[model samples]
Target: MSDLKNDIPDFQTIMLPMLKLLQDGRQWTLNEVMRALTAHFNLTEEHLKIQVPSKQMGLFRNRVGWTRSYLKKAGLIQYPDRGVYQITEEGKQFLANNPPKLRMKQLEQFPKYKEWRQTFNSGNTKEKQATRTEEQTPEEVLASTVEELRNELATELLDKLKENSFQYFEKFVIQLLQRMGYGEFREDSTQHTGQAGDQGIDGIISQDRLGLENVYIQAKRFSNNSVGSPEIRNFIGSLALQGVNKGVFLTTSRFSSSAIQTALDSKQQKIVLIDGKELTELAIEFNLGVQIADTIDIKKIDLDYFEE
Candidate 1:
């Protein structure tokens, strides 16, 4: 049910045991290695059932597969036949050293493995080059890569947002709030009123169809400077004129600490602040200005049928 958790070992952690299993110089099938390692690690049914993000392969099974690939690349093992592998003489010699752990750093020291890494370099990454400390499951690597990409996308989106007109920012605020499941029950529940003399209000959202309660919105498209306490006081004063106690102040820069304190100190009024970074994050999360690019699916063999 879970996908790639910390409880499961990475590909590197399984390297030593995988090599030791073949110490007898006997050929082993992939299924045999999996079964042996399953018991060897004392992995439970729940552990066995745990999958990668794609739900195509078991998390532990994927790690074992990568471990086998790395060992083969390092010349520590060989595939004599389809789905059947055995320890090589070089592997036996390496094992004779009885290294505490067979990590990527150890594998890169081998001439053939180092050459293979240079040719393919799938195993080596900027992360591995920097840390080279611990092995991460492919899922873990993918998650980190995805996070980095999102951060980059958020930065690009924020820059473009600042370039747009204040009217666009006002519309973006109303549309984003609607996309986030606000004012969805009624038509025209969210409105943009950013034109001449809009009384410090950029937009408004009706809580219900009858408009018994409303949330005032003030969107500021600042390129550099932060919103100060004076701006916040004016916005609060604008809300006071409307006899409203709820408001959202959004900006393309940031809020001054004093401005934040002002909002917190507003006794009867509730004001939520959204800065540039948070605004971009919400824009990306609610799919305001982004599109899905690709999806990956990892597959696994039907080990139960093979066991039978």
Candidate 2:
């Protein structure tokens, strides 16, 4: 089994076989493709159990997922329905040519895939070529992929957030702060002050159960208009009315340069400004509104282990 680990095929090596399996022209479920490929590859149970670095998924299965994605992108195979895989006529024709192996170089021959990949690189280079090049280690490729996924997720989250009501935005900020360990000691430590909110303050979180220490929040669900200096100054004034220091100003749009300057220039108060991008990122990091759909771990030979 340990020896088989070294022999396990990389995603590129798995791609051709996966496409062939799909070329039967009948829709196959993902599990069916996975099982057929497992037998085709002669992978052992231990091979199936071998984990990527994150250990959230089996290494061979992880490679297979990548293989499926690449083949689909190359116009070879597709998901006609959720979890149902089928090869396109183009894939069948390509299989008849009996390409020895499917790799990024081969996929680049398809105009759809080449054009699709350019969107990721956005003129820097192709996505696969940039990430999976000989110049990059496997870990580097994984990191680049994670970064791309994170950026896309952030954009999606922000869009969804903007679709909700202003009232929801107020409660959302409170929930996010609570998840960040801001009000861990009490069940009611966080509250959406809403109408009862002090001045323009939208909500409050008691840093302590006794409410001796508190953090204030002002949420702006602006769509097109950026939060300007007047908004920040008003939030600052609200803090003054409450006679306390710390506050967070969260917005769904962006902060104007003057708005940012106002927050920075607040001498007596501590002000933190969270714009759309950072707000979504924070929500993701704290697992406030997203789930871990999948994970892949990267690994390498450890020179230090041999030394040890």
Candidate 3:
């Protein structure tokens, strides 16, 4: 069943009810509150099973967690211990004045909430006002939107990389390494060793401008298969053949458990592994092959400027 099929309440929608659940001023575990919330919302068993896009956790649970986090940030609740929380005295006082239903605008009355909103919306006022809605918290909306865009970009990047040739992949890895300050100089620091009879070494880089030390590299452009222990051992052997002690194994795929263990247990050399996800993250971070499409700056009030 599609996880999105269930009508999941947004974080804002759950905030007031969640706060009310702790009105008795007694400590409550996350599990207890979640159960109470499930009953309060009248959600069925099937509804409870509705998962998030990642399929790692339930959508309703995620929303409740966010709701709790926002309340904590606003100082309306306190964490007494791991997974346990309680309503603060300020929280009870809030309930005394406000109605059962609390809206985001109403929450702005609290200093902490107001400051949080100002900080979040600072210079991006137009963007924030356009996207702000009653159903979602500003932080949740922004985070989820960024995550969606990032996931899409990652998918596109992997697809484009997979379509390229192995030789192209090797050069791409070298370019990424160079961008990350691996090679001291672009002209002579990096050398491709993936030619015929080059053993298992795909590339090498001088760690410094003087070429005092070298770092061996192995780039594997595998789309789906895992780089296992045997491949890692072969790379280490290639490093030994070159008499190098530092190496990096770059793969457009995951490394097996045994492969990771082998790299860690190696006493003769220091081996660093870059799997597909990590590689894509680095590519995005360093702008290796990607360009920034837009940028936003958030600003805040300068109280000192107006102070007497």
Candidate 4:
């Protein structure tokens, strides 16, 4: 059995010790701090060798990096130059008044840390609940938080998509398909037909840049009512009139079981369905009808490049 004490300390567990290392009011390089922390922890040789799953850096070092980053974000430390940092006046004052040991809850006293925690807590309810528990690993908590944000964004996207007119929705679908590498140019290979007197087909996209093969589209802006088998049948009839073998039916609502079965049973023509949830996911995946608000880059050491 593995020794429980050998496990990598979480970032919160390192916060207090890390802060104390900088309490002497001297500037420190990251490497110097890392070395001091290794001695501070009194880690065994085996513990020092235990690396993250990626086999890049030791697990303990990663936690130290995260601890330092969080402290900086909370205004407890300052990075005067690359890889060099020093405790701030507020951080020194905090250490002077508090006990040598620090914990996550204690860090909430800082306004910056409190604001960061509040933002994190505002995630999906499930994620918020997971965050309150200590049983999960740090990686698990991060993954859950990301998934919750995605769910929230997808919901918002679907809600906005439903508010648009059917003609606009049709145009949006065509634009999305073009972004996904279908139809090289909008005017040449994609066209919106969600106008009065048109059949069930709303738009069309060419499979090839030359516009040889085409895929018909039927876009519906719905809220509560589910797309049923009869609606799918009407779409199939429209495809038949156009002598098309492939068709895509998109709705800002779910498809009923019968509608799904009907589409599967069609032997002559192929019909692809995109319900509200899937439509929004595709929109996000292809970077269509949405913009990236922020980006975070998670980096790991490249061990092989540095090997002798």
Candidate 5:
């Protein structure tokens, strides 16, 4: 039983209005955009799940960002702050002159997308248009489009996880590794620490059979606090006793200069460290414990029919 559905046309239809809203001088957050989109289109969160296909707020932000990026690259919009976006003067002129085509050709005007569009439309021909259109189900089209944008968003989130929390932060890392096909890892939830509370390891995973191969994991769920080198040294020490050469240190907080140097200097085992941002990204990539919400379809125009 799956809860996924195809609804891409919904997004193509919404992009303009989204742009216009930004153009109209209304300042809106991602959630506000979500609510507006859902209301104006008579859509629900369920509808958006298919239209955008993610349950995370960050996903929605990422979609808006892609839209903004396309618009901006085309000289249509601009970002004034971390969460704020506004339309540009060129956006007004483009809207006034162009009748608004939701296909890639129109979106290609943006410099950032020129290469992508050129490649996408390279093989397109009138005779083959109909066949290609029919070949793609609405859901499939949306899935592909959203995935491209998701990759960009994942890259952005990767940089932000380093300043967040260890609990949720670590969860994202574990999920990412699992998604990458690394399994048999569990988080540290032990209640007793033999007088040194939770000192054994943040988490552990067996990369192979025979229990001979393993990677030690440490997730620092710091809100803004920085993790220093002494902690990293301790984790390395634990790994040495087990003769494991691979370890991962993840933190919602950034690591100190000394700490990072120490991990590299340890020379005993290789340690991979993931901060908060990277953790969230891995979670998205792995789809660990995450569910798909909805899908959208973007269709190209049949110009040949008009020429005929």
Candidate 6:
């Protein structure tokens, strides 16, 4: 058993609030819930760790899918379409009646979940059977199917790394950054000369040659905890160490009110903080050694052609 096994309750703690936000008759996208989750909980969306239970290995997609899978299995939620999730009647009823107090071991207590699992397994087999009958090229199928598998695996990776601390997580992010072409990036772990402390600057990356320019980064892996101004201030101080003026503060958790204010207040320093949410988005954007798992093509109608 690993740390995440023990941190299951923490993941549940997040999932409960997530379910509540969807209780209304509104459909929510994954990004929407992620935003609400980050703001409400003060977590970083970009982080593989705090974004969900499994993010570090870049398994963001699957972790989210797994959460929905668990919720749907427990009759706590439903997926109306790709990337869109809504609460079901049973899910609403369960919430109203039970008011989820999540426990890793207690997930099995939901009787509806067990029944749902039986039906779900049955349906999955039927779907597989139907797919087997479809006339499709093996290569074509492999291309698309491989992507889906990759996406699922990415989510799982993130979930597995969620329980690690900031120190360890920093190494992960640094590696990720280096893959994105940050060659001179190295972790800063101590104080230097006057006004040259390591504060928020956990790692430094040289952007250009001549050793004249660099980007400082601050990585934080928090456990359901919010980072405050002090951390930010220290990071700003670190920027001055090598005479670098620009910095990026990255965190797996979220920032506090003062933290955001501090960044905005100090215009001269030019500090950019990439919290968990943004970090994940960048990883996806850069394709920083991460493979794409799926691409769902949704067809929409041209109304003019169908006009009577």
Which scores greater on lDDT, model 4 or model 5?
A: 4
lDDT of 4 by residue, 147-194 (tens): 766765665576567666777888898887788777765568887788
TM-score of each model, paired residue for residue:
0.56, 0.57, 0.55, 0.57, 0.43, 0.44
| Residue ranges of candidate 2 with Cα displaced over 4 Å | 1-134, 196-198, 301-308
Location of the lowest summed lDDT over 10 successive residues in candidate 5: 187-196
Per-residue lDDT of candidate 6, residues 58-164 (tens digit): 34433455566667656667666667789988767757876646533445677655543332222322134336646666665556554444434443344334555
Q: Candidate 3: TM-score?
A: 0.55
The global Cα lDDT (0 to 1) of model 6 is 0.60
Supply the TM-score for candidate 1: 0.56
Model 5 lDDT tens row, 1-308 = 03324332333456687776766765567667666765765645664554323444433444555565556445566555566667777777767775656534567566534532332232332223435657888776555545555644543454345334545555555556655766544333211112235564655666665555666677766644678888889888878876778988877556778988888887768987765545555677567544565554557899988995
In model 4, the clashing pairs are none
Error of 3 at 80 (Å): 56
How far out, in Å, is residue 281 in model 3? Answer: 0.8
Supply candidate 6's per-residue lDDT for 248.
70
Off by over 4 Å in 3: 1-136
Candidate 1 lDDT over 152-239, as tens digits, reads 5665577568768988988998888988878983558988888899999999999888888899999999976889999999999999
lDDT measured at residue 229 in model 4 versus the true structure, 0 to 100? 98
Candidate 2 is scored at a TM of 0.57
Q: Candidates' lDDT values, in order? A: 0.82, 0.81, 0.78, 0.78, 0.58, 0.60
List all candidate RMSDs to the true structure: 18.2, 9.3, 17.3, 14.8, 12.6, 17.5
lDDT of 2 by residue, 170-272 (tens): 8998999888899883678987887753589899999987899999999999865789999999999999989999999998878889999999999989999
In candidate 2, residue 289 scores what lDDT? 84
